[model samples]
Target: MGMIKDAQVSVRDLFRWRQRTVTVDEQGNEHVTFETPSTPPNPIRLLRSISMLGWGAYLIGFFCWTADAFDFHALSIQTVKLSQHFGISRTEISTAVTLTLLLRSVGAAIFGIFSDYFGRKYPLTVNMWILGALQVGSIYAPSWNTFLAIRALFGLGMGGVYGAAAGMALENIPVEARGLMSGIFQQGYSFGYVLAACTNLGVGGATSSWPIMFWVGAAMSFAAGFARLIFPESKQFIEARQNSKGSSTAQFAKNFGKMLKLEWKVCVYSIILMSWFNWFSHTSQDSYTTFMLVGKELNNAAASRASILMKTGAVVGGTFVGYFSQWLGRRRAMIIACFMVCCLIPAWILPETESGLEGGGFMLQFFVQGAWGVVPVYLSEISPPAFRAIFVGLTYQLGNAISAPSTQIINALSDSHTIRNHTGRVVAAYGPVMGIATAIIAVGLALTAAVGPEKKGASFESAAAATTAEAVTDISAAAAPSKAHQSSSVGQATSEEDLAGKKGANGDSHAVLTKTEYA
Candidate 1:
């Protein structure tokens, strides 16, 4: 245990962890005798540090995820119209949403493993292609059954996209930029909402043919998929492929089994954390419009305006908070976001009119999703390099599946309570209950993120010996050789000689080394 801090610890054990003390020599060189993770570049400089290739890779993944979000909300926004077309109740149409959420875990498992075992490129390309086809197919559905059937397949295809895209973008980039890029990447969902909303506005709402919207979604997905082909396979994945002992299906299965045996605790904790995260999002969002329409007596126009404002805020907040997490640390930023949401509860729920509610609702989502913006990168960093794609995607979708009924729960709670409006008519109490439930979910999210372990500035490369050597080299590079030589009692380590020798001795070891800087 020369460096116990580098070893992955359980979520339950993270609280027991102690901070390493930094000691400075007489020459003003720093040393950490205990284990500590590396630090990325400053948040402002993070973007400038990445190469153009990194930005291109990130944009490709960003739009792919955005398109995925666009396709999903395409159906959701049309649920009322779809219900009317099928001569079914709104509640019945919700079956499709439930199916999409539940079956996403299936897609994540299949695609996650496939992407991890194969390469990130081809599987993701196929996933996007199938997703586009499904969107088109949904347009021509002859009956309710056909629509639902197409959606089930869509769910599976949709599930695979995030892991593949995230792995492609995140694994290829320089580690220092990952924190800042994570925020931009995750807002693809909010950006998708904005795009879908624009499409809805352009097409003229419910009166416009819903099929037109589906066609738009189909085109976006196809375009995003094909766009990914323009980029090369991720470098991390290429390295992983080279390091892999076997390429056969049997070998893949064995490696997967081994990954599970080694990282089961991480897996379980990830799922639990994701579950609360999903609930926090869905419960706060799905019912807010209903609260406006029912509880505050907002007109259709007002409710729509508030929703648009909320999503816009989500896009802005998600990116901003995500970037800030690089400086603030992931757990601290998330906890701050959660508390900020709690503070916004009053304006969010207490307002009696649309004008009052709109600002609060918009600001509320800003903080909520701002915290969410950290999720993809945070999860990737914590996961074993060999299974990053599978672990992050599977855990996220499983959380979505578990929280699939959050909207229903809110609706049920709302239905159970009755209150008189200004008109003196009894209606479900949506505002007060929603506020209470959201506040509770916010607390859960903060606690979960606080307890979770972070791997800030961890190496994405999976090759053990080379990875360790690389970490040390990176630290030395940051220190500046002449400065480090003058400062440390130990001799200056050169990348070619000292680092390479250490690589052979610790070929199987994997640890992100602590930083050492000379003043």
Candidate 2:
């Protein structure tokens, strides 16, 4: 014990964790240290290496996505123009959109895994460049085949962008700022939609050729690509890379293994919640608003205004949704969002006459926009870094896939029906169905809320903040400490220390809950 005390005084390891002392005997020597398990940390933070230039570059990626969304309705309506140029049937032209979605999902899966391997910046920049090239090629597609292929190819880039961008965002920001910052970042599309609407509205959608939209897409994609060319790899990605050995392949598999270990029940519930609520929200809200204008038989200007108003409202609503989530909690916020849609859906469907359409469109867009923002913030909080990219890709692209089919099915149903009294009420007809579906899922969520969403303030734990000094003080109170020198335990403290590190500062970085991360 005498020799142990001296050696312990200058031991192999000394950590301060909360306010506790830990002195253990090892190899006939005393090892003394301190550790603090519950010492709340300063918050996770990123170095300011990424300046405003990086943000601008990062933001342009979102702009490309937004432009595509704005062009969707116009493109769908431009079947005649598209058909003439593409030399295919309406069905074939439609496949361009459908396949784009399908392939985008595939791209997300591939690149999401790749981002976990190759680093976020390079993949993101490469994808942006590809998107730009495709957008430009799309501008001059000589036939339907060429156009369809280009669009489908573009989906790969688009898909890659989502996960890579998310990975990049989360990789750089402060831990405490993660929730709110991510909330904002995820809602970029809704805001982008507003920008798209403004472009269309300002330039006059009818006067503008459809090709201009792709030009817009190309420009934004190129801008982002060029800008990100200079950005650094995410620091988090670097840390993850360091922890890894052998091959990126091994790490990826390990990540997948962790994801597989996730509580199956939680996984299922998350998928359901994401798919049902998310799909319907897009279908019921965005699709309806655009279609409602056409249904109202309103002139071009009024139609454009209606679209503009709805998306503008969406932008405003999305921006504030995170604040609401902070108070109500993510799960409850989701529940309330669905409930809000259910109640307002009636209003959306029953605005009665043309004049009332504006009010209906305005009211429904609020929830549609707001509910979406809450989703990203909630999911990221639950995801751990290891598998965040994959889960983000899966949930987001999967949800989009569900909605894409639902959109097709609803369009088929609407055109199939004929009601003399319901002549202009076609768009509204889909609302209650979506609202009902959402409500049912929302109920299941409330029932399993405990398992699905993560604890909001739980990011307080940072891996870096755990130290030996604090650890030793907390343990010393037992006072009757006696242990024969036995074995040695390394004080590397990988997992818990990282948790402390994550507490650095919260920023709106993209955090998507990957099953691996959750595990």
Candidate 3:
């Protein structure tokens, strides 16, 4: 019971969002401290800190995530065509998507654990290859069951790629660069959606068969896999593997178990936070188009145009807001975006005319996804080093799994409610339901972010190093007050190094500071 209390207190303290201090020394070199919130580096210095090697890794990871989005949007965009092919209702066809979301947790657990135990490179390579193959198989599926089977398999592969790619991209880069790059990297999802929309507009319009779009996605996945192969293992992963060379198998297991036992509280809290975020995104995005057409009585062309505009807004908001997270702090940026979304709900839902609805959708998604832009970096910062991939990926996918039925839930809730359209036809009041749900979710997002922790520039070296540091601190603290002070100072230095974005020996001096450091 005492251990449990300690764990709870540690988690509460670690995640309680606090400001950090950024200071520049006499040599014009900047240092980051956790005293309080202050000035961040200027745009020019931040830009200068970006290295060619870091950018290369980031670009590769970006495209990989982009391809993941492409494949996902392929199914989302072609729901009507798929229903026609399978001779099923649109709701029945939507089961495939729900199943994919639920099953991604299985993939995240599988690949995330593997990436932590082994390295990010091979697992990610295999993930891309499998994703490509699954898309190809999807093209040849003989029946609805077969199509769903392929997608389920595709979900497993899709589940693993994000964690591995995020680890590679963000972990290998200099800490200072992570904030800006996280925004750019995460926008790969929105960019992929935009690309998929264009492809469907062109290719889906031209071909009677939906398989061609799958074929295109498969090709893109193959290209992403090839690109990953050209780049070697990330510096962070290689260093981690090297550091674990002398440890016996049993010791490794013991260390991992200990870390998990200690950090379980934080893990649970993270899952809750991620669940709200997933609900916020899936609820707002997946059903808005349907609501616009059915409830608002917009023409098909107008609805499509509004959707495109919404996605365009997502792209801009995601990139710009992601970059802003570095300056504003992750939680603050997220709350601000969510608040803007909450405020815009009236404009977004109450509009009866096409132009009003279109403009509202654009602005709504701008803020909705702008908050999302911080997710990758925010999750990365809070994650454990040895299990960075697993912790972030598992929590994220589990949240998604929990929210798998969001669309169905919203649909059911809105079915009985009706509103008089401009033409006086009584349609289901999807707009009201969506507006209320989204508003509630926005509040939840803000509260969760408010209470949660921020490791704005935490280290990403490896989990093993963190465990070792924690052990040392525990021993030293028990020995003498002076030694405990020295140990605390060391932990503080690690944070400074993590936040200051000083170039390490390999030009990517990433290190793992233990969770106890934060506590």
lDDT of each: 0.70, 0.51, 0.72
Q: Is candidate 2 or candidate 3 better by TM-score?
A: 3
Give model 3's TM-score versus the native structure: 0.83
RMSD of each: 9.0, 12.2, 6.5
Which window of ten consecutive residues has the lowest lDDT sum in model 3?
21-30
Where does candidate 1 stray beyond 4 Å?
1-44, 243-245, 294-300, 422-425, 464-519
For residue 57, what is the lDDT in candidate 2? Answer: 42
Each candidate structure's TM-score, on Cα atoms with residue i matched to residue i, is 0.80, 0.70, 0.83
Task: For candidate 1, give the lDDT.
Answer: 0.70
lDDT of 1 by residue, 315-394 (tens): 88888888777666676678889999999988887776776777888899899899988888888866655567888899
Q: After superposing candidate 3 on the true structure, give the runs of residues whose Cα lies further than 4 Å from its correct spot.
A: 1-18, 21-33, 36-40, 204-209, 247-251, 297-301, 352-354, 462-519
Error of 3 at 310 (Å): 1.0
The top-ranked prediction according to TM-score is 3
lDDT of 2 by residue, 71-146 (tens): 3444554443455565565445556666666676778787777776676677777777787788789878877677
Give the C-alpha miss distance for residue 32 in model 1, angstroms. 9.3
Judge candidate 3 against the unseen true structure and give its global Cα lDDT, from 0 to 1. Answer: 0.72
lDDT of 2 at 268: 53
